[model samples]
Target: MPRAVVRQRDARHPALPRRAPTPPWTRWAAPVLLAVTVVVQVATPRTLDLSFLLAAVPPLAALAYGPAATALLGGTVLLLLELPHYDLGHPGESDTATVAFVAALSVLFAAVRSRRDAQLVSVRTVAEAAQFAVLPPLPEHVGPVRCAGLYRAAQRGTLVGGDLFDVRRGPRGVRALVGDVQGHGLAAVGTVAALIGAFREAALDQRDLVGVAARLDRRLVIDAEDAGIAETEMAESAGDTGAAGTAGTAGAAGGAGHGEPAELFATAVLLEFAADADELRVVSCGHPPPLLLRGGTVTELAVSPGAPLGLGLAGVAPPEQTAVGLRPGDWILTVTDGVTEARDASGAFYPLTARLAALTEVRQRDPAALADAIWKDLVRFSGGVRDDVALLVFAWER
Candidate 1:
């Protein structure tokens, strides 16, 4: 049976657990705040000592009811409770002063909350956009190979992380690459972007996978060094003055200088599927070996194991290219450590090869169905992912 068809069938057979519902507290914050206000009122102080607690109520209410309702509730609470505590030097004077202070404070709190909410929304939007642009959607098919991929960042609201994968049909054949930067977040994303760009450019220009890998390594190192120089200059400028900028500058310098070489380096596997020759070639750099699944058996391809790119290691031998003849209906699966390393509640790693073999026996050679079965087993094995997992499967059809 084709892996794609098997994956599609498995996707329809619900396997994973359903997501839990959001808690009541997240839905009804205003009532919670009102209850807190009652408790505070019971324990109120005789003097203006209640000012701090009263001031806190508006922000809490805002979190529950939103800005406008928060302001209204806050204003009403102040008028009913705090107004009587104020002394009137003249007619309507006390009322005017209390109302003025409450209104001002309420508006200030609401404005701050509104601004924060807007900023959060903006960040989420940008993150999603970046993720979509950087991580292009996986193609349904490539040559005789059926391909599917998934990436999930460990951090919430962050779409793109340090992981990346690219598959393209070229003159050489169908080439695919999956890589992970040493760290996470924006800095790692920058390296991923640079590496992916270099890979695409070099892959087209160079027939050798090793050449493509080297080109990407050089690009990443150059970018890392440039960032380091900028940080050093900022540090020196700050040192000349005793301003608060000095601390920030020093921290930046420390982070850039003392950062691990791995943070600058990337682990990758580049694969080439020559459909005409019916062979698969691979080059690995400190990355997990690609698994070749055929006839219900899985084998890790042999490749020269070398240091991850951008470690600045000299005299290191270049990676060796390994090739394997593909049988009809054979499929190659490559993934980052995120898959095998995913742990369950008992801290046991997912047995990817074993699971793949099991699923292969049960499902037909449908690409989609195979992908679905593999992902379901992955989720079940890991219990849940602690980091992002990226998988690329390529199969030869007849």
Candidate 2:
């Protein structure tokens, strides 16, 4: 047996690295500002004592250079301030004391900022852990399909985001969900956690695709009530709320009217691959369609869009399942808007289909290889991704 070499490609947009401590250019900012202030003071008609501007340098240095750099900057500013006194042959007693005070204050500022940076690092670590718990690693193999996925947060130093994807083996088949909550940060992540959690449980218990979709709707309604959103249960329980954001009954997931916290809504796609059938069942909830590649040709599955999740199911028709033929050697690619909406320097959107069309034969044969190729190509297309990206690639091998 020969070993299959899978090239590690950029799977999802890479995690945003923590911002480096003060940049090199900013290190000289205080000094430059100090010099300009002194020049203006010396050249002014009223001989304005702009030396007070020197007070700002210590705080600036503390933010940009930390304690050691601030100490050095403090010394320099003191020296510069004293030079004029030396020329006048009248070095004032209060001026010397004031310079010493500024030096001490700079050290204090530096210490405070250093502490805050450490706290920030701790917060990021905890967030990453929480995200992992919400969207644990998916199995490399799901029944007869080989699968791979990636997720990247839009904000630097953040691990969890509104974008989410999950795969589970249910009674019906191997079910998968990919969705994007309508916001960012902790709030969006909370909604993501809620949605994925509901889907995982529903995938196993629900007999039909519509049943699973209904379960998700009910779960989001429960979440909305717990959060004390403005919309009462009366409207939702009565089946009067209309679809919100992209779809679903409004206020069921988190849709509040104007002046309240904007309700949470998510675009999603649910897929099931039954072992007994040679086809795939899809229910789109106002999400971007999945792309299918076979024989080196790519086609976007055309699904009539349904309401997004979080909207209650009252009066809403059951989601129609679109069954697409699935054959051996075919690949299914699912992505959040982050991938399709990514833009380049020219403001042109990423050409996902064209790039996938260009994939080499070797890359198309292996699921991992295919993922790597798409990620690398997407990175090159977007320069750097500005939003969170989540992608799921599956190859039918049975």
Question: Which candidate should be chosen as best, given lDDT against the real structure?
Answer: 2
**RMSD after CA superposition, every candidate:** 8.7, 9.3
lDDT value, candidate 1, whole model: 0.68
On the 0 to 100 scale, the lDDT of residue 298 in model 1 is 83
Whole-model alpha-carbon lDDT for candidate 2: 0.75
Q: Rate the local accuracy (lDDT) of all candidates.
A: 0.68, 0.75
After superposition, candidate 2 runs with Cα above 4 Å error: 1-121, 225-262, 345-347
Model 1 stretches astray by more than 4 angstroms: 1-61, 64-115, 242-263, 312-315, 343-348, 361-376, 382-384
Q: What's each prediction's clash count?
A: 23, 6
TM-score of 1: 0.68
Question: Among all windows of ten consecutive residues in candidate 2, which has the lowest summed lDDT?
Answer: 1-10
* Candidate 2, 1-398: lDDT as tens digits: 11111223222313523443457777788889877876776666543466667777887788777788789888887787677642322336786677679788888888888788778767755655666688776678889878887666776655668898888898878899998988865568888888888998999998877778888877776776666543444445444434454234544443454234236578889888876888888999889999998886889999878898777765676678899999888889999999899999899999898888788575545776677667677788888787878888888888
